[model samples]
Target: MADKPSTPLLDTVNSPAELRALPREDLRQLADELRSEMIDAVSVTGGHLGAGLGVVELTVALHTVFDTPHDRIIWDVGHQAYPHKILTGRRDRMRTLRQKDGLSGFTRRAESEYDPFGAGHSSTSISAGLGMAVASDHLGTPRNVIAVIGDGAMSAGMAYEAMNNAGAMDARLIVVLNDNDMSIAPPTGALRTYLAKLVSGPVYRGTREAAKAVVQKLPPFLHEPARKTEEFARSFFTGGTLFEELGFYYVGPLDGHNLDDLLPILENVRDAGAGPILVHVVTKKGKGYAPAENSADKYHGVSKFNVITGAQAKAPSNAPSYTSVFAETLIQEARDDERIVAVTAAMPSGTGLDKFAELFPNRIYDVGIAEQHAVTFAAGMATEGMKPFCAIYSTFLQRAYDQVVHDVAIQGLPVRFAIDRAGYVGADGPTHAGNYDNAYLGAIPGIVQMAAADEAELRHMVATAAAYDAGPIAFRYPRGDGMGVDMPERGAILPIGKGRIVRQGGTIALLSYGTRLGEVLAAADRLAALGLNPTVADARFLKPLDEELIARLAATHDVVISTEEGGLGGFGSHVATFLAANGLLDGKTRFRPLMIPDRFVEHASQADMYAEAGLDRTGIVNTALTTLGYDQAAMTAALAKI
Candidate 1:
């Protein structure tokens, strides 16, 4: 681990109150110190480094000007809240970030009072801040509410919805637009272009300030007309006329890195009167770090690294990641299938569509942080006879559920849903976990849902989705690397709604879904050693429910354990419901469905989380033994042997 950087100025400030006590001139030094400390802390505990680096000055300015814990300050997505966390007295625990029982990578309401609202997703801060502002109004309190949102997050329709609502209400709300021109990937759509134009236009800074000043000095009756005149002229100069029309008192495209520039603007906005106000502050992602600044992604998310060299530490992987496999397979399939096209909601790289874009740039589309738009756009393409694959993360797909139901499922459009990160994603925690997709998507009638047991299986499922044209079809794969299985030349589209048996046994059967097949097979091997060989099968399709295989297992075996890396109402629940409804549970068959517990799992290593949920190898063995009526002592002894 790298040694902690010296932060002499930062040492004195343990809290935001302490920071607020400092003189304005000394704030520059404090901001520099904060950036260094953030870099050092993230060097030890890798996380969202570039975003935090970008927000150092803005965070200091906000904390210094506003009263936190009392005055609400919400960070959209919360990836940029590391500096906020340090200033809010979490510096001591900074090194333990994103670990088991440690500081969360994103903001958590339970973690600190300063983090008024928890966030791990984007475009929520403004709505939440507006709600707080209205609540304070109702309570007759004079507290200020500020929401800091990035430009990339602005692409989502929800941000505009909140802005429209806040504008209409004329609420006393402050929204600081952190236009860093980046959000994981380079931003897309007209919003990014408008922001860029706003920052680059020479008339934006001086002309807008002069207009505000001139309008303030005019007579009370003429002030409204003069302000309107200035807004029309400013719209010709800068592109913020849209914001003005949205009912916000639009402020500048100021320098976010300069405390001198940021402090006064934030202070003025903090002291401003009624009506929703927007202060646009321009920033550079990975501002202070040279390596990150030079990189295309600006090291948006990073691992522990050397401070001087900026070389991040990465664990060596023996196999390709599930994401890469999907990308490669999709690319290969697209070569032969001219009708195939790809769509992603501003996550081209994360969903591996970046690689697809390289091969078939015309076929791939980035819909810009609008999941609903991405799904519907794919549905539209499907209507035109194009096989559109909507590649999205499982967690992010939740935002477009209505579109998935109404646009695709209801119409029975053959839009291929490539759900990446379908299970518990490590570091990112519950907010980004693809835990609920199985349950949610399975409930929709006529939609085919499949979960890959490994990397090779994922390739086949992708092919399967591409080949199937009946209705909406989705295939889910977990985050991280493949199981090092031998690769085939190309994927073979498997029989839809059918499962294949991997191993044969007699007394008990383990029906696995998604990536849990490895652990199930491991448990099967252990049971075989103990003279209790169990049948092992991978139920690839969750929605179609592999009824024949499931019935055969239940009838032949004394016990059947259904396992999946999903929530309570997911694959396991579906299997259990099917078994009970089909009278498969009426005989001597004792069925146990192993799944994620009905509670939100915290940030931990994936292995530890599965163990905690009792879904690990030992956990599965224990469940089988206990279900077979083994005594507590025998169960413990059997587990100990494994």
Candidate 2:
């Protein structure tokens, strides 16, 4: 009789070797248990629940079959690596996912031996894994290197480039195509169509195998023609003549959830040595749970939720999110104008274009995981006299800098960029944080830039960007909920490069941008109580300099305190450069640029990150008082008023 399946199956199993030690039937049950545990953990912590749940069977099978740590497994985007983390030694610390000092939401090389390659951005896995494989070959220390890439990520040119190169080099790498047919939103484009063809044509595989047997005996000289005939036959059946042309051992569109299918295929590939191989494993986005399967996007990334009800455990708040505000404003504007079209790179919900897409389906474009393509596509639409609003996150837009400069800015097209997550994004960490958008966009020629202070300002900025067809314009807004300000009934555009003075003062001038205005206001109130009246101005435009307003404030006040939510090469840096280049710093006015210091800030709550960067209200106030030569007593008095 077989012994009762050990509790040690879940508990004592820290690594892949331990997992493999269990019976094959036990391993299958372990996959089910892992899925259950993952769902429970994610329901409480609220992370990438769906993707992780979908990859449970695949994850268990891969780790159990392959020699991990030594055998590198590169998870594309790393969102689905929760189960992988749990199976490894990180099971105990899984609760600390995405916390300041805890495990990351995605895979991290530093976190565990399991995570061989770190990834937050998609389409990088294949290249990274191929490099590892090649390096292993060069060192005479051969080991298996597997890249688990998603169907969503396959839309990008870089993934294809990696596949193209890997196929040519014939690197002994295993490429697992985890096809859920979605990337936040449903996948799009010509490549997606090609993958669909690969799925539909099963007969092509048997035909190719039969032809390979014939070609092997064809005296080496006649082998090329037989191979060509097989390739032509495959092209006739499957539209993916492209993959064959690149020379890869393409496998299947197999059931990723079924252990029976996944186990044997993975074993075959692991043992079958030489040449880059592509294993297409089709999966449901949210596999075990019914609710997640129905609403995959909603479950893609979630806040804490009730497991029983499958309801999100949202905090009671009346304040509207910045994303909702942007969506509403886009709908309002698009309703008024026919030419107004919206575009996003696989982030319809994140960028708040779902309503726009629903309202005007023809006008909305969901370019799947292709930032570079989205920017240029928007540029293409703009040239045809259509107003294309490229709604992309700040971090993702960084991928399209060249397109912005060459295609849009150089041509002076009306590509309105709705840059969301314009500051430090919480939980998801540094990779997804929209920190550099302001600094980078400001540097581009023939571009107009603005940062919104609140939801109302974001509306106005969106309108401003839409109306000003003079050139490419971008208005950035932070993540999370707004300050619950009274939103405008109708949208109106603010004057280009003009700043609004929030408060009047005597000694110091506080010039701030975006959400940093709130901090500046707090500091001003604190200073006012200490008998140092500080005037505040919201420098709306980072480019076009707002030179007149900045110059006036500088000449009028003894000190100018510039605050912006970005790093050294950001708004404050630009302000400092302007003051120095314009010869404004040499005189009585001393410019103090309060910006994010030169360092990569770690994962934390946005508030905590702001405090660390000296951009919080207290930090901002203290800096202002110190610049004005005030003691602690004076600073305290200033704080009393605020």
- Local distance difference test, each candidate: 0.88, 0.83
Best by lDDT: 1
lDDT of 2 by residue, 340-402 (tens): 999999999998999788889999999899999999999999999999999999989989899
Separate clash counts for every candidate: 0, 1
Runs in model 2 deviating more than 4 A are 1-8, 182-225, 228-242, 631-642
Per-residue lDDT, model 2, residue 280, is 72
Residue 520's lDDT within candidate 2 is 81
Among these predicted structures, which one has the highest TM-score?
1
lDDT of candidate 1 vs native? Answer: 0.88
Q: What would the per-residue lDDT of candidate 1 be over residues 1-642, giving only the tens digit for each residue?
A: 556677888999999999989989999998888888888888887998888888989999999989987999999979999999999999999989999889999999999999999999899999999999999999999899999999489999999999999999999999988989732223344454454445333445446677779878878899888877877765554457878899987666666787766675676666556778887777888988898788737388898899999999988989899999999999999999999999999888888889999889899999888999999999999999999999999999999999999999999999999999887888889899889999899889999999999999998998898899999999999988999998887889988889999999899999999899999999999999888999999999987888999999999999999899899788888878888999999999999999988888899888888888878888998899999999998877876775
For model 2 the local lDDT of residue 573 reads 82
